[model samples]
Target: MEFGNDCKLIVGVDYGTTSTGVSYALTGSSQCNEVISIQKWPPNCPGLKVPSLVACAGSPGRSLWGFEVRPGMKSFAWTKLLLDPTFNCDSFKVEIREVAGALGILKLPEDRDAEEVVTEFLRHVHQHVCGELKRFLFDTMSPGRVPIEFWMTFPATWSEAVQSKLKRAASEAGFGDKVFTVSEPEAAALAVFRISKDFELNVGDGVLICDCGGGTVDVTSCFITDMNERGVPYFEQLTEETGSNCGGINVDCNLYRLLVTKLGEDFKNLSTTMVGPGSNFMKEFEYIKRDFNGELPYTLTLLGPVPREITLSPGDLRGIFDPVLDRILSLILSQIKRLMQSLERVLSTSKIIFVDGFAGSPYLQIQLKSALRQQMAEVGVLVAPTPERMVACGATVKGLQGIVAQHTNAVDIMA
Candidate 1:
């Protein structure tokens, strides 16, 4: 693969706990505005992201990943959480226990560690991304003809050790030596800042980023420092990121428990017979969870031996969601308090809260807006235009910024 000196390709990979997304831009073109997300994935997964799952249950030395890994297969899920050493802390005890139980029941091969599993999954992602690049750029130039720089995003709360491990995994997965890393919240912020036209951001104004994903929710606050002539906002971190295990998966778990309580003995059979990936029960519930906005009642039908209809009223949905929502709310408020302390003043009316990630639920957004309105009436809560792809897109923006900085530095040196 010969690199072309005149052109370069920048790729961003957002590897979340439940799914992953990819975005890329050709540096020879415009900056962040021209960034494109890779939406085509194998096995016909219809989304901007693919499942972060890998299965090698039956075939040795051959792994199936993403949409290729079908339900009912013994696949590795949520392996991204394994990279965090603090995942076992008291706050995440329930999540840790759940992961352990799933691993034990699935009986994944003992030979592979979490890093290796993640590497395998990422390898598949890299391959698919490369294939897409080739397909798209074939008419102009081979992707190999140009240098490729890869950027990956991780949870903001992750430690240096976890970041290093994730970087190593990405490198091993064929991202090459040019693998760069960015915090998820920062990346999401960049994405929102680049495309946000409605908000008026001035110097020193505070912006809070809430990234709610499948397995965790991370909150970060930053203060705008400068803006370029193009209206791109630049900000500096104002506080250490705070996060928790309360995410969309927890909602699913809550719903499962609710069903068990509601159905009693009937749940036992339903759980054993129909509860798994690709199952109708899981699919229907996922749709309900994604589209539910606090006013709708959802009816879930169970098939197989214990066929029955369970209607979840608005109140029941609220019961399942409020606990998780409350946790996220606490995280945001804590960050806000910290920001206020740092600034040594009350939060200004110009403050903006940007929310992204797959679990940035519609109901969650509504709750955030309502709650923040009551607490800080002038503060606004805005959701990213492409919540699921925000991190990946922001990563490309970061990469583009790096390229621009390098070019400027080279010119300065020559001058």
Candidate 2:
């Protein structure tokens, strides 16, 4: 309804390891309403879950990132895989180097590898947001001065060093010096709480927020106490937990490995087999991996020394993912255990958990919910009302607060 300037615009970028999301909102006197939200996976996507990939194909030094890279998988782009610190797969390493060279950022150190890729992606997003803002506002007003600010979120478990690196990279990515960082779960919680004001959670009320994102599980417990003069609510942290390495990607990897192992038996005699003989193996693998409903089929044909049909029954495929799903469930339970342990030391009360993230994985969600019910018998855990939109919306609200208050103090930061 209302925006900051009706002209001045702010951007929120959730630059995730496995995927990236961008949300734009206007801040003004009435209310800041979200304009658009984009969540992309590796390579570029037109809709939700664009691939976080980068590659190069044309010249030896040419490069590609986001949706531009997916078509040429064998090219120099190694977007999602390169983000992992321990990604030592030889082929992946070679591809990453090629990608880096193509992007003109190969001068970076070996250990500081993925950071550069991420930086470029952030820069790309920055350009996109700026262009969008210009297109939307340039014609309407005689562009005098537009104060542009960017808000990027990271996992709470990110070390101070990582957070610092992200901030510096965001600045380098063309956001200038106006880029700010917030913990992902906190931002989401702020969004959910602001809209659900009638819930009226108290300071003593123990609430757990679980963010089930693509690359991480961010969980935090907080107590909401009051609202600032700007009308944004305040919260105090109680217990925080994260599984930085676990997410939908791991599950995808598991499914890929399973299809390879199960279907490997059919190709044992074949030579020069690439994840099976199909050019579409990688594409199909990506699809099957993220099919949250678990109603998809995995089928492939191999040809070489022996030509045969390889297919997995839904039940057989489910068997492959069972262990991976169980591990995630265990982690969620472990977080609950930690939350209870912390709460016991402080006070005695009923616990309520808020689960969020891109946890549309039917298999994963069922496993997590069952585990949550069993582990915290006395506590209540409900998925946040708008799990997918929580973080982006919350960041917008917090950004508006900062604008209206005209104060950058910590006390006023999320208040």
Report, for every candidate in turn, its global Cα lDDT versus the true structure.
0.74, 0.55
Can you write out model 2's per-residue Cα lDDT over 290-387, one digit (the tens) per residue? 46355666675543455556676777667756765676666666665776687645643244444344565555655566666786576554556545
Please give each candidate's TM-score: 0.88, 0.72
Weakest 10 consecutive residues of candidate 2 by summed lDDT: 406-415
What's the residue-level lDDT of 72 in candidate 1? 62
The candidate scoring highest on lDDT is 1
Show model 2 residue runs off by greater than 4 Å. Answer: 1-7, 29-35, 39-45, 57-62, 74-112, 138-142, 197-205, 226-234, 265-283, 286-310, 344-357, 377-381, 384-389, 403-415
Model 1's alpha-carbon lDDT is: 0.74
Per-candidate alpha-carbon RMSD to the true structure: 5.0, 7.3
